[model samples]
Target: MNGSKDIFSTIFSAGTFQMMLRSATPVALAAIGGSMTEHAGIMNIGMEGMILMGAFFGVLGSFLAQSAFAGLALALLVGILAGLFFALLVVRYKSDEFIIGCALNTFAIGLTTYLARNYFPGDASGNPNLPELNLAFLDRIPGLRVINHQSVLVYLTWIIVILAWLFVYKTPYGFWLRASGEKPDTLRTAGISPKKMKWIASVLCGILCALAGAHLSLGQLQGTFTDNMSNSRGFIAFACVIFAAAHPGKAYLAALMFGFFEAIGLRLQGFVSSDLTGMIPYLITIVMMVYVVVRKQRRKMKNE
Candidate 1:
């Protein structure tokens, strides 16, 4: 009993909680990105590629320019170009989104791997790291103070969450975005372009996903670009989107749940094998997917 108690305490300790916040940031941001495209009838499986590229470029820019902001700017530029290219293929050229997304993932891995091997050529590259902001005003707060000294992106993510919620729920563009997915013909009848909405959604998704990558490489990883650093976070974000029914706020909460499990997994590494511990977050996500399916089936029966 005491052993179990200690294990639980170790997993839920303040340090673990702090790691959870950092772990959740990238996933939450990606979930928000995925939600944008999902609501606009675009299943963006390409976020994985975008994130990989963004992390690579983020590190590249910071390493070269010695400024995190420069890295961020470069990443966003890549994101914009990626979004437009994806739109041209999936929207204009009418290619299969799934195929294109898979291609993107493959392309990113190859490209980043080549660049890393030829240029960075190491386990990690530590550039001018992102600034860690101190919440001095919250010093008096007990538990909150512990998390006060996180990266600037952590603070920015909170504001982005609020803005994303407001933008998706309380704005006219939000209605049209949703309408484009559900009722494109109706939206067209109202003199709105469904294609334009989709294009915009793709671009927004790319930007957010790029930001997620920046947070990972610069904010969390501290300007290190590892091979496959994204580690399926994009897919996890996609799961969050479906679990939350494409709602950004709820998706963020779902990401936090996954992040908590990831932190727990990291904490358990000493007690278990690294491989097994690493599976914790993915296992939790799979379990959640099953629960979602069961709940939907029950609801369907009730409605019938």
Candidate 2:
């Protein structure tokens, strides 16, 4: 009973909530980007590679310019250029999106790993910790104080969530993006280029995903760039988009849920085998995917 109580206390502690938010932020941001691409009829699996590139370039830029802002700007540019490349292949050349996505992921892994070894050597390129803002007033509000002392990325993620939701549901462009996926013929008849809509979605997704990667390196990990630091969070974000059915707000919530599990896994490391503990998030991801698939099957059957 005492052990149970201790476990409960630890899990519900303020530190846990803070960790949850930190873990969730990058995933939430990437998921929001994934939602845009999914709405535009694209299943982007290259997000992992995109995230890795962003992390590498973020550190590289900081190392070069000695300014976090400069690093961020460069990271965004790299992400945008990567997105453009993807758009050109998928939209213009009509390449197989899946093949291109896989190629990107492989290329990112190879390129980043190579650069880290040759240039950074042991991932010690720069120290570019994002400033953490303290919201002391929230301390008086009990649990709300747990959210204080977070990085700018945390707040930015919430703002992006709201904006993404509004853009997807309340804006004309959102309608066009959705229509392009649902009925390209109808969109074409309306004199709108579905390809153009795809380009916008891909570019936006790249920027957001890059931001997510930046947060991983600069904010969450405190400006430390490791080879493959992204570590499948991009894929998890993609899962969140699918679980949320392409809704931005829902995707963010799904990311938060995954983050909670991730926090739990971190906490459990002391109590369980490290290998088993490491499997927690991936296991949960598989379960979530299974649940989504089962629910979808049920709905399809009912419709039939």
By TM-score, the best candidate is 2
Q: Write model 2 residue lDDT over 79-161, tens digit each, in one string.
A: 99988999999988999888998899899999988987876766554467678878778878986887888988899999999
**194-251 per-residue lDDT for model 1 (tens digits):** 9999999899888888898888999898989998899898898998898888888899
The TM-score, computed over Cα atoms with residue i paired to residue i, of candidate 1 is: 0.93
* lDDT of predicted model 2: 0.86
- Per-candidate local distance difference test: 0.87, 0.86
Error of 1 at 70 (Å): 0.2
Model 2, runs deviating above 4 Å: 274-304
Q: Which segments of model 1 are wrong by more than 4 Å?
A: 122-124, 273-304
Report how far residue 294 has shifted in candidate 1, in Å.
5.4
Per-model TM-score, in order, reads 0.93, 0.94
lDDT score, candidate 1, position 129: 75
